[model samples]
Target: MKSLLRLTLSVLIISLVACSILQREGRYFSHPSTISKVDAIGSIPVRISLEQNWTDQTRMDFWFTSQGSRIIPYSWFMWLEQADSRALFRDAGHMEQLRYLPVASSAVNPAGLPIGFALDTDTQTGDAWLGLTCAACHTNQLDYQGTKILIEGAPTLANFVLFYQRLVNALTVTGKDDAKFERFAKRVLASDYSAESAAELRNSVLQISLAVAQRQLVNALPATYPADFTSYARLDAFGNIQNAASAFALHDLTNRNPPTAPVSYPFLWGTHQSDVVQWNASAPNTPIVGPLVRNIGEVVGVFGDLSITEAPWWQRVLGKKNSYSSTVKMLGLGHLEAWVKDLRSPQWPQQYLPGIDATKAAQGSVIYQQQCASCHQVITRSDEGQDYIAVKTPLIEVGTDPAMAWNAAHHKANTLILEGTKKDIIVGDKFSVQAPAIELAVNGVVGLVLKNPGEALKAGLIPEEHGKRSLLADELSSIEDYLQVNLAAREKLTVATKAASLLSESELHGLVYKARPLNGIWATAPYLHNGSVPNLWELLQLPEERIAEFWVGSREFDPVRVGYRVDQGLSKFRVRDDGGEVTPGNSNLGHRYGTELSDQQKWSLIEYMKTL
Candidate 1:
């Protein structure tokens, strides 16, 4: 017994020593400085808006131009700049690589930054970070014949997964090389750093790199392959956001679920007018608060600073002594929502896609009014003069695919959000459906911090007040106050704003899809909620009659088909016919509403839709 005990002690000591050495010498390093800030920047037309109205155009331009968050720091993303010899990212013809970037008009920032990135200097550090904005996914361009028609709200074809995977791999590989680390340090720090600062910077970049690499590895594993390896253009947006929120809460990779049910990105042109938003139509589209919550969740999924490090019980017990850290810029959310609200649907260009007979379209309009107006028409309220789609159509089984709906319906968000009681009374009572506790909690914390900066300073939530913190807090508080006022004045409104105000949480999670106004439906292809059907014409056919499988992520527009060009060698991603390739929550076999229409009638309907 004595000998065994001595051996155990020796082994334990040795293990601790090994761990300590690994911590001190491991290639992965993390420092607070390495987590870059996404500060706001001056306007520099990364992409020009197609909108003709100056006010609306400006907002649309900014909306598509700015990055809402700095998910990856500029230095780490452009790590190859240290080489300066080879063309890091380039393409031969059509400037395909540059043109393919989600940035507007293929224009770079004034700093000659990459597409889909905006340069913003850290308010305190004077260091610039590349931030990604709404345009990365929301903006899209299509080539009709030889003319490039920039569609502001169409789903993007940018290969975000590959871009991120490459980024993670590059950063991790560079971090592992000590010689490379010296160059990275010099490049990222932009000045000579003390040994401590150098170590901190290297550690910070390594930590993020390793985390990303591990996630990519996990996602690539066979168990997660179907869910994670989604095709270009389509992504499991909500599922990933839910997993990200879970990861933020647990601070561990285990919390993340395999992202399944990759759905097409829904255009945002008329989202503000919807009674409830989301592919599944789960979230309420409250006037001020709802948009705020949705945007906050987006920022979190994209590596924004808002996170829940410890469980609520732990947080309650520890109070200011908790082990979590969160930094949020909730102030800008209202502005973002306001800007996006101004976005109008892209009008179909008659000049490019000519040969539409006005007589046929007029006949088609009569067909649309008779056959489709019941569900697809937008009604303007006589009393309020406000326009809204009248129906939040129930979970009618139209059988195109049930995957996205099923995932949205069956999502176990109880663990991801506050349940039973202890919900933040301020925001929770106002809305439901996982009310974005982390965001609201962060807002509540900001409210508290603004009131007592000294207490927050003591708690180490913020550094010394450089005016930005206080200003941001005040703005966030005012927004919060505005939401509260709106909630109180809900009775005065013609439209219900809260989720509970319109439908219960269970009802909100129903297997139904909204029958949105198909004004620009011609622009949005790969139809159905899951994007199973490739075109309006395809959508009007019987489920089995439709193309069983097709390729996505091609920007070549088919005016005749009124959808994206889909052929064998056309696109980067091949959407399989069988459910073999598609993850859970994606099936292309429902919504047989207009399928029974005669062939000529279907053509007429298509012609009419394009006019809208």
Candidate 2:
């Protein structure tokens, strides 16, 4: 029953819990560790998972959850991972921690700065884990293909700074000055650096080389940080989000507190329709009908605990419920409850993604297989690579190998630890790095990676661009189920819609597991876990060698189109520091990387990708 809840959190197959609550219906506090993660005891109204709750055509909640789903204080999530062996799920803890960074005072405009960027000093003893979260990723932004966006799955404040600087550079007044860039980067980096240094030693080093650049950026900005001007200020004031959004805003809080319905994305392949379809979309809304898998799990922040379900969970590794009852301090505040609540965060505008050219996708698959298959397992096509999945694939940068993938993700994720510790890779709270895997963190998956990078990856655990250790291989597997089964369930509706011309057969709409068939690889760029990148041609054009700080509004060219001026790229780059000598940033985004990719290959890949 315990593993059931864990299984539910590990995948996105089916929705199990509602948006407002934390656990599945009838399930109580059930994290494996000292800090248990459960929903409010009988909190919400209807009982379905959130993904279905919102994505369903009705968009109705029989039970009313408070804010949208950001509540369940992240420290609670950290404990959930911790219960599973925090060191093994190192990066996962880092990521989940961000979701619950405390509001500094909840009394001012930027009441919630998130522990990472808060102006407070008392955070040392607060959820202390919250400070650890920022160190887990935000030393700087990940410059994928020269674009200044943060790593897709990992939300970083550095990207916001790069975006701000680029915008300032575009303005005539700020364009002429290079000093600010250096000043800005450094200050943020320093803040992050100082925040992450801890008393303990590590098992391995997972570092990012943002040390110098950080110094340069802060030194340049006059108003610098926490000022009314500059988006950097917004990041300082608002934490890792855009405009007025906070990942832990009031909306996110309320929904997670007393969820409206059961919202887990449980897997449904093996179960008999009668046996597994309780969350049906029929008049009664049974769960079974046409589900993705027999497994009742989820991918979003949805929760599920089989302890509450009719069936019994086979794996019962966790022993007790004390973890749920324990109080973890947060944001320098004491006695934080594991109780789920709602935090209403800001919402990004929903701009529908226009469809990509189908023809081009076909052309992209060949390249995709060659470059991407090493990490992503092809579920639809044979290993020899013969079939055609309609959409071009290539989103997940991880595969069936969990041990190794976790290691790779940790090296990238725990850069602050790498910088601060510069030594041993801490495995688990009790064990150090062992023969197979490298324990990367004292508390979570970081230790697992440090202990056995290879083994972890083999198990199929890799961080999504957002830095959560959910495997791409499994996601692909479920998507197949979701695509085929979900469609089958709605087959009658689809047929009726076409027959009635409510929508032409060709003009139909449906959800696919969040991936495309990647046979046509080249045309699918810009790449991202989230659809943040724009075009393939632009991706191919970026520089290969450097890990840059993607600046959105620099004075160079905008490889990806943007309406703003100063859409510069890597070419005209220059950085100054130390003795004030000018050094290069990225010359191009990532064009130079595909040295093996010839003009014909690149073109052919692009052409082929569209067909998929």
Candidate 3:
């Protein structure tokens, strides 16, 4: 036992040392000199009005409320530095440098931790944790002539990969450097500062830092694969989520797969109303259960604590199942879903941008009906309960990159560890030795929902029509229905594939990306599912004619082009498609619908899109 203890300690020390070395060598910390120059480039004062249904209080709740993701202890995040320097990691001045929008402290956000950062306190332990809310990735700000326009539900430019890497680096450094640890301890413990407390804090920081570092290694693309960075405004969400649930939670490294298929974050405006969501339309948005399951899965992916373990002997004897535990906040997730149901799309800011040319817009409206209206439907902004079933266009029909869809549809994982566990602790089925990664992820999320019945009930998971039924029965029915819908959607995609029989099952099922309503599409730049096209002007041109390379981290908008300005020297996130061997997730191809239009016709369509 003593020898084993020594071995474990040695391995941990070695890992921490390696992580510290990697932090020093890699671009994990931002230099103070490289702070963004966006604010210094003169300001444009303009009155902004967003046409959204939610009130000020709702928006505040959405922005700051926690979804039970605990990235780190709240106090540590408040005091950590940039690894090599004493500069605060959460400093607003360097927010733009990290591609996150900076916001002032308000009544709702006393910590002033950027737009998406939220404080979650453990109800049992009273420990405050810092985690991200949906707004971190969904809310966006565009700089038009030094005037910032805040758009709810739009994809943000924040570089998630960079943010996470820097955080780990800071924690690793604080653990290794005595001076940094002393300062961090002082800030975190203030009144309770003691030698024993300092040692305990150091151990906590090192353990979490090491764990996150190990997870990053598991999610990384194999050394043989090309370096495919997710960069700003994009994330391989499904890939990461599956990895967290199957590999990290299950303690099975072999279940890990490279998170190579990063896609642009979808806007949330009409998402709740849509029958399906996600780039591939894998999730079914069925009333209450649908949104709750989807959000819980998202929370799991974004550093939410999830643990899948063997069922206890007592549980087994009692026939109770599901040993899956998670820190997912059920009521918070439900509130967020409710808020999103009424969140309206941002209309064109006519006061800030050029006025629409009525003649051109009218002509473009006709072209839209002829060329675009079939797949991308229009939605009524005010209709909160309107059902908008998204149209799924096959990958062959809309020739965009098939990587994202393919990966989600086909990625498999070893479920041997969960073999005897109920497929969903609440309802139907049981796990086999092997299953799709998505299946395991769904199972994990379902377990979380079922485990917290009281929270689920409070979160409005029980539908009005099902109120008469027992909570367990209603929850079980919802899970079964949701699973069936997901299975049916996958089958539909598989059946619709026109690919040759020689193609794999993964390729067949991945042959579709959903076409959603284009309302507020103008705010979501670098178009297409993978965000390969830089602007609407270029997107209207042939895919072959589009710029092969452009930077993506800038928030400065080009109103004329209807996208963010892509300046090579100003941004670090350079998206390239040399047309040799297509980059796994960054292919700038397909969606040939409007590319053949005349320049005049294309410009008209662009003007018309601004109205949406």
Each candidate's number of clashing pairs is: 19, 207, 0
TM-score, candidate number 3: 0.86
After superposition of all CA atoms, the RMSD between model 3 and the true structure is: 6.9
Q: In candidate 2, where is summed lDDT lowest over 10 consecutive residues?
A: 334-343
Where model 3 places Cα greater than 4 Å from the true spot, the runs are 1-49, 224-228, 420-422, 425-430, 461-510, 568-579
Name the lDDT of candidate 1. Answer: 0.52
Best by lDDT: 3
User: Top TM-score: which candidate number?
Assistant: 3
TM-score of each: 0.72, 0.27, 0.86
Badly placed stretches (over 4 Å) of model 2 are: 1-355, 370-440, 444-535, 542-550, 553-612
Model 1 scores a TM of 0.72
Error of 2 at 4 (Å): 51
- For each candidate in the order shown, give its overall lDDT on alpha carbons: 0.52, 0.23, 0.73
Candidate 3 or 2, higher lDDT: 3
Candidate 1 segments exceeding 4 Å error = 1-49, 52-68, 79-86, 89-115, 120-127, 177-204, 214-229, 309-328, 378-387, 413-421, 424-509, 568-583
Residue-by-residue lDDT tens digits, candidate 3, 1-612: 546544544565466455434433422212212211222111222324476777877777898889988777666776788887888887775566776665655655545567788877666555666789999999888877767788888898878877887888898999999999999888777666789878877776776687667666667775645443677888888899999888767755556677888888889988877888788777776655667778989999987767777779998788864487777888888778878877888888878777888898899889998889999876656553476788988777788888887777667788866786666554445777877687788788877766765666556553323224334345554444544554455345444332323367445433678998888889998788888888899898888878867888887888888998888423433345344666767777888898899999999999888888
Candidate 3 or 1, higher lDDT: 3
